[model samples]
Target: MPKAKKKNRRKKYNYNVDRKKLNRAFRKRQAPRIKCSQIRHAWDRTKSVSQNLAEMGLAADPNKAVPIPKFMQPVMKMDIDGPEKKSKIVQKPYVLNELEYQASLPEKQSQTLSRDLIDYVQHMIQNHGENYKAMARDEKNYYQDTPKQIKSKINVYKRIYPEEYQAFCTSLQQEKMDKQ
Candidate 1:
């Protein structure tokens, strides 16, 4: 029997290899071409060193460029001649006498009792008679003063407005005198 003929398969085209070849061709064609005239006019090793330095502004004298004003320099320190003396700062103490201190403070004025307050106290004294403490606790009394406060306020009232208090004291003295 004759052998079957083998089939010849075509190879697949590779895109990467084709693309690289096209890029290489384009780069070579697009490369810049330098002219001989541009190179001749350009700075090269043929130019003198002094001419290159002058063109760079390095060859000019720095002193002749500009005069920096003398006033710009820092001021010198003043000459302090003799040996250094250490001077101390002294603070004075507050020395005030008792009278001077009292004079400096504000003065408190004694409060004067009103006629209505005097009358009220006289009425309470007449009704309660020596029982001021009970009158102080009574709700009917205008100022529900505590026993201690009531005593002090009565004493102050007697001193300030003494007419009623003096009359009460005189009557007591007269009763004692008559009994004697």
Candidate 2:
């Protein structure tokens, strides 16, 4: 029988020099042309664009170019030389009542555990009691979570459904009493 050819498993790092050169030439051709008038004398090659703009005295700060007035400017009304017209009648804005406002609001959604998750927690508690290590090792624990992770899941369940969790604990205690 003829011997099979050995496959090369090593990674090849071949740099395409021709492609790099072509890309560099293309980028140079596409470079933006800046006008002589656009170039400021106050501009520092080492400093950023904003710092250069601020140094030029063209703006106080590049970010806050437009200065905010300390007081609101009065609205100016101009009289036009045209035929006299009747004043426009203004209507009051429609206001919604409490009921209407409540109706307009979105309904609140309550987060509840899935049946499978609830059953999983119940099974873990029944099989392992408070021992998270035992729960983590349980065959029902398909996710193969650590003991800390198992404890955190149980804590989340307890926090989300405190009353239900309390009732569940009572039921477990009753089951133990019955067994005795």
Candidate 3:
């Protein structure tokens, strides 16, 4: 009979490393403990607002107290509704030339295509529907984008956000049903 093979026992590896010790290993040194007291006994019994004021020598007297300050007392003495004050009309300091005035005036703001093509397409569908040409012709829809670009953007928006497009189509159908 052949001799039996020798049995070898493997040692168990421990992966339970101390996290706190590991964190402090790379640090400058062990941090100093907080000097503040966790439980404060001095503030256990607190004083009221009136008692605090009296202690600071700022106690107010009700009899001598005025609702308005002395500075505002003079302004309040004048009656607002008594009579309107007379004033002279001031003339223009310099006459404006037509050309200079025109040049100085703010330029008209031009509309730019929105980054959110989905919203733009949804708005166009609600307002314009399948009439791509008429939609492009509208001032609100134009916004630097040509008819072809607008159509392409609409197609892209539909492909990317199918759920929103489906909802929009359903809403339109419901509107038509309601109208009928």
* Top candidate when judged by TM-score against the true structure: 2
56-108, model 3: which lDDT tens digit per residue? 33334554333454674565476778888554232221222333566699987
TM-score of each: 0.31, 0.43, 0.35
What residue pairs are clashing in model 3?
A: none
> What is the descending lDDT order?
2, 3, 1
TM-score: which is higher, 1 or 2?
2
Measured on C-alpha atoms, candidate 2 has an lDDT of 0.71
Question: Against the true structure, whose lDDT is highest?
Answer: 2
| Candidate 2 similarity to native, TM-score | 0.43
- Give residue 9's lDDT in candidate 3 (0 to 100): 55
What range of 10 consecutive residues in model 3 has the weakest lDDT sum? Answer: 36-45
Candidate 2 local lDDT, 1-180, one digit each (tens): 876666456767768558888888997676534343334333356777655544444443644656575566565746688778753322211212333555689977487888889899989998889998888889999999999988888888998899999999999999999999
Model 2 residue 73 distance off true place after TM-score fit, in angstroms: 16
Candidate number that wins on lDDT, 1 or 2? 2
C-alpha local distance difference test of each model: 0.60, 0.71, 0.61
